[model samples]
Target: MTQRLRFRTSIVLSCFVATNALAHEGHDHPHEAASAPQQMVATAAGPEANSFVADGVTYQWKHRPDLGLQPEAMVAAAKPGLHNNADEDPETGEVVTVVANYGLVKLDQQMKSWSLVDDQDPHFAGGMNSHGMDCFTIDGEVYYASASTNTQEVVVSKRGKVIARLESPKGTEFDNPGVNAYYKSGGRFVPCDVVWVPTAKRLLVVTGYSNGDFAISARRVDGAWKWDGVAFGGRIQQGGPFLTGHGIELKITEDGIETVQIASRGHGRLYGFTPNGAMINLNATEGQYYAQLHNAARPCNLDFQGDLTFVPLLDSLPSTNGVAPVMVLKNFESTGSLIPAEFDDLQFMRHMHGLKTVRRDRKLFAITLSWRNGGENGQGKLNDGQIAIFEAVATQ
Candidate 1:
C-alpha cells in the first residue's frame, strides 16, 4: 500500500544542536537489555510479511533485529550516524560496516555475534573522539577514514593500521583553509563526514554545525595529507556557505561532471556543488530548489543505487501520511522534488542516521542505523543503536 506524505517543515534557531553530542568517542557507557537474535532472511509469502509501497515498487522490510553490541563486552551499543558505508568483507566474504565508535564490525549471518576487527584511531593523542567513519578498498587493501569531532580532524587507517591524520594547516588555530576570501575567520574543523573518491584519489568532507559546517577537500601532497580547497560553507556569518554541512557523497552526472551532494542539516536541504565549489541546482527551478522544498525530516547520511536515493531522518516527525524513518527519492538526478508519488518507511522509530544498500544473490537490501537515546544521551546510555535491514524489489 502506497501512502502519500504531506509536506511539513520544522526549523531550529541555532546550529548548536551538535555541541553536546561531541563527548561519546572515548567514554564507556552502560548497555541496553539483551534479547535473542531473529532470523536474517526475508520471505514474500510468509505470514510475517511486513512491507510498504513507493514509486510503484513494493518493499518488504524485515528487521534483522539484534542487540547491537561491542564485540568485546557484548553490551548494547549506540552509534552516532555521522557517516556510514556497507561493503563485503575481503577476508570472510560477508557484509561489514565501518561504525563511528565501534570501528570495523562484521554483520554476522546468524546475528549471534558481531566481530570487531579494528578499534577506531583517536585522531589526536589525547582528544576525545566523536562519531563519523567510512571504509573503502584500494589496491586490495582496506582503508578507513574516521571523523574525530573533539580533535576536529580525520584519521585515515589502512585495515585498522594508522596511516594518516588530517588537520588544518600548521600554525592555524582554526581550519580556515583560506579557499574563500570572503569568510575572513574560520572556526573549529569539527569534521562530521568524509567520502573518498577512488577515481580522483581525493577526499570530500563536511563539518559540524556550530562554527564549522564547511565543505572542504583533501588530497595527498608531498606524501602528506593536506587541505586542497573548499567546496562551500564557512562560518554562518559569511552569508553564503551552508547552514550546516553534515553528510556528503559524490555523484557523477550524465554530462561527466562529478558533483558533491551535501546534507545541510540545519537548513533541511541538500546542496550540490562541483569540486571547485560551483553550486549545482539539484532541481531545475527558477528560484533555489532547496529554499522551496524544506524537508523537516532532517536529512542525514545519503545512500544511492542508480536512480534511487535513500535518506534517513534525524528527526522523529512522521511524513504527511505516516512515519518515515527513511525516505526514498526517485530520479534524483533529474528532479529533487518530494512529490507524493516519489516520496514515502519503517514504522515507530526515531532519529535514524545511517543508510546503505547491499546486493546478494540478486536481492537488494537496505541497512539502517539509529542513534542511542535518540540524540544527546542525557542519561549517559551506551552507544548501542537499533539496526534494521529491509529487502526492496520492483512490483511493476
Candidate 2:
C-alpha cells in the first residue's frame, strides 16, 4: 500500500512562522535580519581522492550509495556509538555512527557501509519514524533516544532494543489542558532530539512543539521514566511566547556551572539556561552573536566542546542553490565570538541536517547528513540522502 505521509517540513515551517510572529510581539529588535554576511576563506584541497582540506581541516567524503541505501530513503543526524565490531583496529578502534532515517542504522566498519540495526523493533508498535537521536553509556549499556512518529514521544532504546517509551507526563490522551494543550492536534510532541543531563540526573527532550507550541521537557528516569517539568523559551513558568525547540546540548562551564543550551528555530536564537530553567544572560554585542546567526529558515543541530559550539545551517527558505554552512562560536559565556566557516562545494551536500563530533586516533572528526527531495514518486535522482565525514584540525 502506498500511504502518503504529509510532508513534515512544510507543516513544521508553517508552525514556526505562526508561533514566531506571536513570540516577537513587543520585542524591540528586527528579527529577520542578519547582522553581517558570513566571512569564509578557501583552502587547498586534500591529497586523497575523496578527501578535502579546508581551513587546515582534512575531510574524507562518503555517500549513501556507498552503503547501498535506496535512493528514495533518507537519513539525518549522525552520532558516534560504541564500537559494535569485534575485529575493529586495535589501535584506531572503529566507532559506529548511528543515523535515524526510517529507522536506526549503524556504520559497519568491516563492510565500510551502513546497516540497519533496529527497524523492526516490536516496541515501535508497528509505526517507526526515527528522527533525532542521542546516546549515553551508563553501566556499560548504551541508551539512545529515538523521536518516533508525531506522537511527540521518545522511545528509549538500549543495544537496538526498546526499553521504554516517554510521552506527556500528563498522559497519552490529546486535548488535555496545560502542557497537554499543545498535544491536542494528535501531534502531542514533535521532538527533535533528546540528551541525558548527568548534572541534573534527568533527560532533556527537545520538542519542536509543546503546550502553547514549542518547548523542552525534562524527564526523570531513576526507576521509572516521568516528566520532571517542561520549559518553554528557557522558562519553567508557562504562558510565554512560543519558540522552536529544535536542538539541545547540556554544557558544564569551566567553573563547574551546569547549563542547557537550545537552538530556538522559531525566533532564530540560541539560548542558554540553568538546569532550573533560568535564562543565562549572554549579553552579546548588538548586531552580532544570536542576532546574526539565528535564522528560523535554516536552523539545524548544535554540538558543543568546552566553550565552543558548532551549528549547521541547513536549507534556507527560498533556497540558496542548496548550500549549507556550519557556524563555530567560542566562549559561549557572557562574552564570546562567532567564527565563520565554509562548507565544501560537494554536489551531493544539498539540504544538510544533523551535526556531531567524533574522535579517532586522537583526531577530531565531524559527521553530517544531507537530504534532497525525491519528487512525487519518491524516486527523483536528486531526492536521495548522503552522509559526509570530515576530519577537523584547529587552524592558527
Candidate 3:
C-alpha cells in the first residue's frame, strides 16, 4: 500500500473562552499574515558582496548568518550591502528588502519574509553590474549611488544603459566663477549629495564642498533632462541662510521636497524647498546639545512632506582633532554631518570599513556599504558583515 504525503492543514490560533461557559481551546500560533515579513538577517549570514560607506569609508556586508558556504568561492563573492533595506509601514511592522550580490559578478537582493526566498524575487530580473559603485533600486530598476558627494551617475538596468549623469556645478556649462558660486566639492561637502530625481524625471545631485570653504549647489534638474532650474553653487546650509553645498539631507514627499541639517555648534536648521525651487521655514530645526566627534563623522539627513519636515541630528562629538567633522544647515529645520565616531563601523567588533547612512525616510533608509577594510586593496579588518538596524522614530 502506498502512503500519502500529509502536511499540516489547519492554522493554530488563539483559544476563545466564554465567561462562565465551557472554555474554548485557543492555539498560540496564528495564521501567517498576507503582507511582507518582519525579519533581520545577522551581519555575516546576509548577502555577500555588499558595501556600506560612511564619511569616505566603506565596509563589506553579508547576511548575519552565512547559509553555510557550500562553495567557498560563492561565499567570498556574495556581498549585498545596505540601501534603504528596511521598511515599517505604520500599518506594517518592520520589514526589509535587502540588496545583495548573488555571485561575485552581479547585484540583487533576497526579500526576507515569512517564507524563505527561493530562486525568485519580486524585483528580480537578472543582474546589473555596479562597477564598484553602490547599487540600489529606485522603482525596481537598478541604480548605483557613487561614494562621491558632488559627482555621480545612475544607470537604470531596465533601460540597459547609463540614463543619467549626476555632477556638481564645477565642470557643467553654467555661469559661475566666484567662490560663492564655485562647485560644491571645490568648496564644501554633502551627505547623499547626488541622486536620480524620478519625479522631475532627471538626475538630481546636491553639493556642499570645501574646495573653497564648504558650500552647497545642485545640478540643473530641468524636469526632463534639459530644463535646468535655478542652478546655484549657492545651496543653503544649516543655522542661517548660508550658500554652501550641504543642505542637511534631501527627501521627496507628497507636498514637496525637504532638505535638513543638524548642528553641534549653534541652533540646527532645516530648509523646505519646492520640487520646482522655493523655500519656506517650517520651524522644524532647533535641537541644541553638547557632543563631540570621536573617530569618524556623523550622518545627517532629512525627510520632507508637504510643509512637514523630519530633520535628523547625528554624528555626535568626535574624540580626535584630525579633520574636524562638520555639521551644516540645509534649512531652518535640517542639518548635515558625517556619521559621528560612536556609530563608526571602525568601532564595531567585526568592523567593516565604511557603513554610513546616505539617505533616509520614515519607511526606507540608505547606507553606503564598502569593503576596503584597510587603505586600498582589501587590507582592513572585516572578514564578514551584516546589516545593523538602529532604533529610531521620526516626528514631522
Candidate 4:
C-alpha cells in the first residue's frame, strides 16, 4: 500500500495514537479510541496544491519561501535557513517571524504580505539554526522578544527598532548562588524561546541549552532588565535535563490563573508551569507534579487555542511509522493530525519546528514553520526553511 494508505489504515486501526506511549509513560501498546476514518482531500494543481476540510474548517498548506517582501530587502529572509518561529500581535494582526543566521521580518497586517521594518537591515541575527520570536505589548507599548541564541541574550525591539538587550548582567540576581548555574551558557545564556507575561510583568525565557524557563524582570527597574532567577526547571522532573528547551506560550484564564505551556524539545515532552515557577498539572497524572505529554522526538513548539494545542514535531517518530509531522492535541491526546504528504509532498515540510495560532476578522489561522525542508527542488539546501499558513474560516 502507498504511505498515505498505510497511514490511513493505521489511523483507522488504532485511532490517532501516532505511536505507542513511551515505555516510561507506561503504555506497552498503541492507544485505542473510536474515531471515524479521515476523509481525504483530492490534490489540486496550483499554489495551494494540498488542501483539506475537516470539522467545518478548510485547511490549506502553502509553502512560503518568499514572504512577499521586496527582493532587495529580502537579504537575509530570502535565503534558505532555519525560518523558525512566528508570533502575531493581536491588536494589529502584525507578525514577527525569524530565520536563524538570517534575522527577522514582519508579515503585514493583511496576513498575506511581508516587509522589512526600518533599522532591521540584513535580517540575520548571527544564530545557528535555533531562534524564536514573540510579539507582545506592555503598558500600551508594543515590543518583540527575540531569542538571540548566538549570544545567549534576549533582544527586545519595538517598531522594528531594538530598544534593549536583556542579558545576565554581572552582580545582579543572575549572579546569585544556585540561580546562575541553571541558566549558564558559556557563562551567559542560550535563550531558545521567550514570552512576555503581562500579569506577572516578566519575560519567561527558555534556557535552550540548559533546559528551563528563566524569568527576567521586564519591569526595567532603574533602567535595566533584572533576572528573577529560574522560573521552573533544572533536571528534576519526570523527564530530567530537558536539553534544547524550545517553545513556550502563555495562557491567562478568567479566574486569574496564569499557565505557560512549555515544549521541552530535547526530552520530547510538554510541560506547564506558572509565572512563579510552580508546575501546573493539567494532565492529572498522580502527584503534585505536572503531567508530561509525549508525542514526537524533539517536539519543537506549541500553540494552544481553547482546549486544543497545535504542536509541530521537529523530526519523525517510529511509532508514527515515520510520518508524524504536525499534531493537534485535545486534553493532551492526539485528536487531529496533518500527516506528511497530506499537506504537501512527502519531501516538503519534512521537519515541523514552529507553530502559532492566530485569530483575526472571524478567521482562525495556524502558522507553522518548517526548518530545512525544501519542497520545490526535491533536494534543495539542507538548511532550507519554509512557512505554511493554514486558515480556518468561521461558519456563519
Candidate 5:
C-alpha cells in the first residue's frame, strides 16, 4: 500500500534540528551504555517485504535486524580488486561492500548480514565509539573518514589492512586543508561527506558544523596528498560558504567545467561553487530551494546523475500528512522545484539519515539509512537501524 504525503507551505524548524547530542564524544574514551544490537527478526511480509516499487522505481530491500547500525555512510564495490584489501566472499569470490557504522562493516552480496572489517585495527582506536563518517575508494585504496575529533585522521587501508593515516592539516589560514576547528578544539571533525574527482586528482571534504568559517576542504592528490586550498564560504566574515556543511557532490559539465554542490543544513539550502571558492548560481528562487519548499527540511547527502540530483531530507519532524523522506529535483541545473518521493508508506522512513548511490552487476542502486526508530541511540534506549536498497528503473 502506498500513502501520499501532503505538502504544506509552513516549514517546521524542528526538521533542521542537529543530532550532536548523540554524536561520538571522542575516540577511545569511555562513554555511557552503547546502543544495543537489533534483534534479527524474520523478514515480515507486510511493509517489510523484500521487494517493492515506488515512483516507477523497483527496489529489492534487505534488513539486518540483528545489527544495531547507525549507518552514517557507505562505499560500494562492483568487483573484487577494485577496492584492494576488501574482504571477499568465500563462496562467491567477490568483494563485499563497505559501510560506515560505528566502524567499518562489510556487507555481502546478499545484503542480509554484515561483519566488522577490523575492530582491532589501531586506526579505530575509539572502539564502538569510533564514528566512521564517509568512505571513498581510489586506485585500489580505500579511505575511511574517521570523524573522531580527538584523533581527526583519515585512515587509509588496503585489502582490509591499515596502511596509512592522513592527519588533519595543521594551519590557521582559511584555505588550509584541515578538519573543522571544532575537532581541533577537542570536538569531532563532523566530516559529513567526501568526494574524489579523478579528473582533477583532488579530494573534497565537507564538515557538518565546524568552528571555522570555511566548511569545505579540498586537497590535491596527484602522487602525494597536498593541501590544494579550501572554499565554499571563502572566508568566515563573508558568511556565504555554508551555515552547516553536511553533504557534497562533484559535477562536471560536458564542457569540462567542474562545480561542487554543498548541502547547507543549517541554512536549509544548497550552494554551488567553483573548485577555488567562487559561488555558482543554483538558479533557485528566493536565494535557495529548501527554505522555499515547505515540504522540504534539512538537505543532507546528495547524489547526482546527469543533471538530476537526489537529496534526502534528514529531518525527523512529522510532515503535515506524514514524513516525506526523500526529494528529487529535476533540471537541477536550472530553476526547478522539489518533488517529494514516498518511501513505500514505510512509517519509519522518517528516521532516515544517509543517502548514497551504488552499483552492482552493472546496475545502479540507491541506498538509504534509517536510524533506529525514535531517534539517535533509539532516543536514549539503544536500538539498531535499517539499510534499504532500491534498484533504479527507467520510468515507462
Candidate 6:
C-alpha cells in the first residue's frame, strides 16, 4: 500500500514509535512501566477473534477505525485504497496489487521477548539482533521484525494467517550491497516507508542514516531474492555535506522514485531516481518538471498524486525574518495531466502527520494534528490524530 507516503512528507533521524512499538536502541532504558517477565510482554486483550498485545498490555478490538486504533495515540502512517492482492504471470503481464502495507501505528509497546538475529532460526529469523523498526502485512500474515545487524531483509508469510510459531522463509531475497546504513540507531526506522513494485517484481525499503546518508535498495523477487546494492547521499547539517540532507520522504514511480531531501536547515529539494540505479537528477527542481519546493528547518509532510503534489509546509511568516516564525507552506502543483478546475474546491490540511496517495484512485489521505496544544506533551490535552481526505485535480 505504498508505506512511505503515509509518513508526513519526510523523516530525519539526528532527531527522530508505540506498544506495538519496541524500546529505543543503544539506550537500554526501559519504559516507565513496571518490569515484567520477558515472554509476558506479548499480552492479549478484548475480542478473541481480533486482539493485540504490546508491552504486557492487551488491547481488545470490537469496533473502532477499520485499522483498530486507540483514541489518544497518534496515527503515525497511512495508505488508502491499497488492494495488495498482487497477481502476475511470467508469460503474461496480468499482475495487480490488491494488498499493500496499509496504515501502521508505532506504539511505545515493548515486546514480550526478542531474539538476536544470530541466535534465532537462521532460515526463518532476520538474524536475531536485526533492529525491528516497524511492522507491515501483505495478506494478513502478521509478523514481527528486526533488521539484520545492518539494513536488510523483508520477511513475508502465507496469505491470511499468522502462525503462532515463527517459520523461516520458504524462500528469501537478499538486498543489494548498499543500504547497510542504520544497524541500531535508537529505533529511528519506525516511520520508514516501503514499496512493492510489480514491474520490477521487488520490494524497495527506504531507511535513514544519522550520518547524513539516506539508503535505498531493491530486492529481486525472482527465485532467491537478491539486492542490487545501496545508493546513498544526503545527511543532516550537524556537520554533513547537505543541510538537513536526511531524506525522509520516498515515492516510487514507473520510471523510478521521487523523494524530498533536506539540504540545509529550513531548506529542501525534490529528487527523482531510477529504482536502485542512480538519482535521475540531483535535486530535480532544476528540471522543468518542478520548481524548488523548499521547507523550514521544521518539516511537516509532503504528498504527491500523479503530478498534483501537496505539502503541508511549515515556513516563517516572513515578518520575523524567519526568527519569530510566520506561516505554513501548504502547496499544490498540478501536473499537465490533471485539470486544475477539479482541484479549485479542494481544501488542504496543515499541521498533519501521515500523508499518502493511492495513484489508481487519485485519493490522498493524512493524519491531522492540531496546533491547539503548542505541540507539547503532558496534559489532559490530546494530539487526537484525525484523518483528512482529498481528491486531486491537475491541469489535464
| Candidate closest to the true structure, highest lDDT | 4
lDDT by residue for model 4 over 1-396, one digit each (tens)?
A: 000100000110110111112221101112211122122111111112233344545455544434334334343453464546778865677777655555566777766766645576343444523366778887788877777665667777775666677665442454233344433422335577788887777788776443233333344566556665534454323233243457778866545567776776654566667665656655555442333444334567777666556777766655444433666665555555554434443345567777777766766666666665444346542433555566653334
Task: Give the clashing pairs for model 2.
Answer: 152-189, 210-213, 373-383
Tens digit of lDDT per residue, candidate 5, span 1-396? 111111122221111112233323211112212222122111111121233334435444433234322233332211110111122333342233333323355655544455556543644423212222445556655554333333444554453455555555444423432333433355334454556555555566665444432444545355555444553342122333455566667767666667666776543456666666555655433433232222234566566654456565555323323443544453332122121223442344443445555556765555555444333343653323445556554333
Best by TM-score: 4
Task: Judging by TM-score, tell me the better candidate of 1 and 4.
Answer: 4
TM-score for all predictions? 0.68, 0.63, 0.39, 0.72, 0.59, 0.41
Q: What clash count goes with each model? A: 7, 3, 107, 4, 7, 59
- The digit string of per-residue lDDT tens for model 3 on 77-139 reads 323322221221111222212233431122112212222124433222223222213333454
lDDT of 2 by residue, 29-59 (tens): 2343333325211111113333334334544
Q: List candidate 1 stretches off by more than 4 Å.
A: 1-55, 66-102, 108-113, 118-130, 137-140, 170-186, 235-237, 254-256, 289-294, 318-324, 332-349, 374-384, 393-396
After superposition, which runs of candidate 2 have C-alpha atoms over 4 Å from their true positions? 1-102, 108-111, 118-120, 123-127, 149-151, 169-187, 209-211, 216-222, 234-242, 283-297, 316-322, 332-346, 374-383, 393-396
lDDT of 1 by residue, 1-396 (tens): 111212222221122212222213221112211122121111111121234444445665645444223354322333333233344444544455544444456665433456765464442224423245566766677776766665667877765566887865342322333433312333345677787776667787776444445666677767677766444555343444455556777666555556667765554566666665556656544435242122344566676666566666555333333322555565332122121111122232344666766666666676666544434455543333545665565444
What RMSD does each model have against the real structure? 10.6, 11.1, 21.6, 10.9, 11.7, 16.9
| Residue runs of model 5 more than 4 Å from their true location after superposition | 1-102, 109-113, 118-122, 125-152, 163-168, 172-189, 216-228, 232-238, 284-296, 316-324, 333-347, 359-364, 372-384, 393-396
State the displacement of the C-alpha of residue 29, model 1, in Å, after optimal TM-score superposition: 26
Name the lDDT of candidate 2: 0.45
Model 6 C-alpha lDDT per residue in residues 1-396, reported as the tens digit of each score: 321321122222221111122323111122212222222111111122122222233423222123213222122211211111112112222111111122122211111111111222333311222122213333333233222222233333222121222211221212322223232222243213334443444444433223323444444334344444444433323221222221233355444444432212233334334444344443223322212332222223344434333333233222222211111221222111111111222112112322333322332222222221233224532322233322322211
